[model samples]
Target: MKRWIPWLAAAAVVVLVGGGAWRAMAARQQQQKALAQAASQRAEAPMQLAASELVGVVRRSLVLGVPVSGSLRATESAMVKARVAGELQGLTVREGDSVRAGQVLARIDATESQARLRQAQQQADAARAQVDINQRTVTNNQALVNQGFISATALVTSQASLESAQSTYRAALAAADVAKKSLEDTVLRSPITGQVSQRLAQPGERMPIDGRVLEVVDLSRLELEALLSPADSLAVRVGQRAQLQIEGSAEPVVATVARINPSAQAGSRTVPVYLAIAQNRGAPALRQGLFVQGLLDTGRADVLTVPLDAVRTDKPAPYIQAVRDGKVAYLPVKTGARAVVDGQTLVAVEGAPEGTVVVSGRMGQLREGTAVTTAATPSAPVAAASAPATRPAP
Candidate 1:
């Protein structure tokens, strides 16, 4: 039994040594995995940059356009006035109230005119009675003359009286008709269906002929009147499309050019153009009398463009990025006319070719030979092959 114990003790030592070696191998494998993970983290550090944000560009028509500024106004407007002289008994309208055509807005006192009309009618009736009496007398006198009972001169005198009475009745009838019209003219009625822009007269005030009492404007058909130079006006044609931007609105209202004045303005050297607004069909951002600026889309061409946010202006020179060989470089850009594409304003670069990488938003942190990771950035080179061509020194 003592000899077997020695052998068992040796076997136990061997098992312990083997276990220690296995643990060492396991620890080495773990350390290797940890090192690989650390390297991956280092490589991913550049991607942590919040400066690399993506931006979009706006797409628009290639036709050249002339920009103009203008104000909105109603199509129909009038200064409603009083046509007859009388005291205003009732005024039914106020400023900013809507009214229909031929609606009564005020009433004038017509009591005196009514009485005059009655008097004229009474006079006409009396005249008719006198004519009848004259006719009877003329008939009787003629009969008496024929019978030799009345003189010839008496018959002639009776006929003259009858004619005079008839003329008086005709005159009285005309007078009564005139008085009826004068009374009707006292009611001040609206000549159009529109809103009241101003009210000048009140109840109980006497107005003279042709005195203005209210100002009205029609809002259904509104116009955008833009003043542009004669040369610029030539670029715009009737039926062209127009977009209007109201203050504080992100989206704009669309309209169409309706008319253009052929002649230039006297003092401003400008010509007037009108746009008809489609308010009911358009978005709800538009309203009457809204001051706006406009863009006239004149249609598309293939042009070199970059993301609006990608273009950087903070550098020593305004520029964008050119990526190659896993690194990015700055290229100075000369910009030209701006156009909107896909709701983005793209500044046209003179010589920048297509496929150039523009450092989009927050590009201030990037510099020459900066290592960049475009694996996540859209439309960017996944793996660059070589550096970009350098601008030749002067």
Candidate 2:
């Protein structure tokens, strides 16, 4: 009887253990099934968004510009030099002084020139007196020949003397004219209207003919000397517009293609392109030899564009999050020119079609084919209480 009681006890313990294990397994299976059902319901649910969050893509003309860098220079520039040699006696203009065409800028010491002119004038006068005396002598000789008081040979000699005196008088007159011209050249005048950029000679300094006095440049007629490759030069044409950004200048100066050098630079394949600055009201002051950067507008085309922020750049290829049929759709796009339109920075895109609605601002996490709802239109406001209300339906 005792042995039978021990076996029964063992069987009861085994049954209790097996029952506990089965219950644990059942609980785990039910928990996993519940989790799977919850996930499926969430996936079927739609995503909702406000209408104001979406921005429509637009089509507009985008101007494309080719970037170039070079230096700024005056289109018309001259180095003021002395035409005659003398001591620079007076200089009325200095560096940075504005001058007009034909304005006298400096004076050379003309004391010696003046004295030489006067001396030549005196010689001319003496020669003229000699000519007068010779003329009277020739007239006397001719009368003597008519009266037969003197031989014909002697009268001919007197005529030859008069001719000699006339030649001397002409020579003296030419010398006087030369001296007058030299004296007039002692004053240096500006040949063009411009500002003095350099003062090469000081007052009271002696200078020779063609000696540099100052450098004058026409500031209003400035140009940018841009170097372009052979390929780029072909695209640039005369009359094309460009924007120049000079070093140290806050605003860009507008310019146009003035001329293109037919030949390439020596030893280099680059061509020299000259851009003429356009005249503008209140244009910023520009100087010669200023380093500059330029953007030449080559062509323009109509393209689809969206706000810069709407394009996502982190992925392997640039794409935009577009909302189509109330579902999220990712679109891969190729970007082109970037420009500002209506006070917003917009990027030109190629793949996206016009009028495609894109998610402009950062909304919560969005997935492919995720459902969305735009904000509903607002209902009309109710009439004021003071106003007569419509009667209840009969």
TM-score of each: 0.56, 0.60
Local error of candidate 1 at 137, Å? 8.8
Best by TM-score: 2
**Residue 245 accuracy (lDDT) in model 2:** 79
Per-residue lDDT for 43 in model 1? 61
TM-score of 2: 0.60
- Candidate 1's residue-wise lDDT over 1-36, tens digit each? 888998999999999999999999999999999999
Error of 2 at 271 (Å): 3.1
Question: lDDT tens digits, residues 1-394, model 2?
Answer: 8879989999999999999999989999999999999988988887766655677677776665666677778888998888789899778788789999999998889998999999999999999999999999989989999999999998899889999999999999999999999998898889899999999999889899999998999988888888887776777899988877778877888888989999998888789988888768877767788887857887766667777678887789888888888789999998876664445566678788887888764663378798877674311111111111111111
TM accuracy, model 1: 0.56
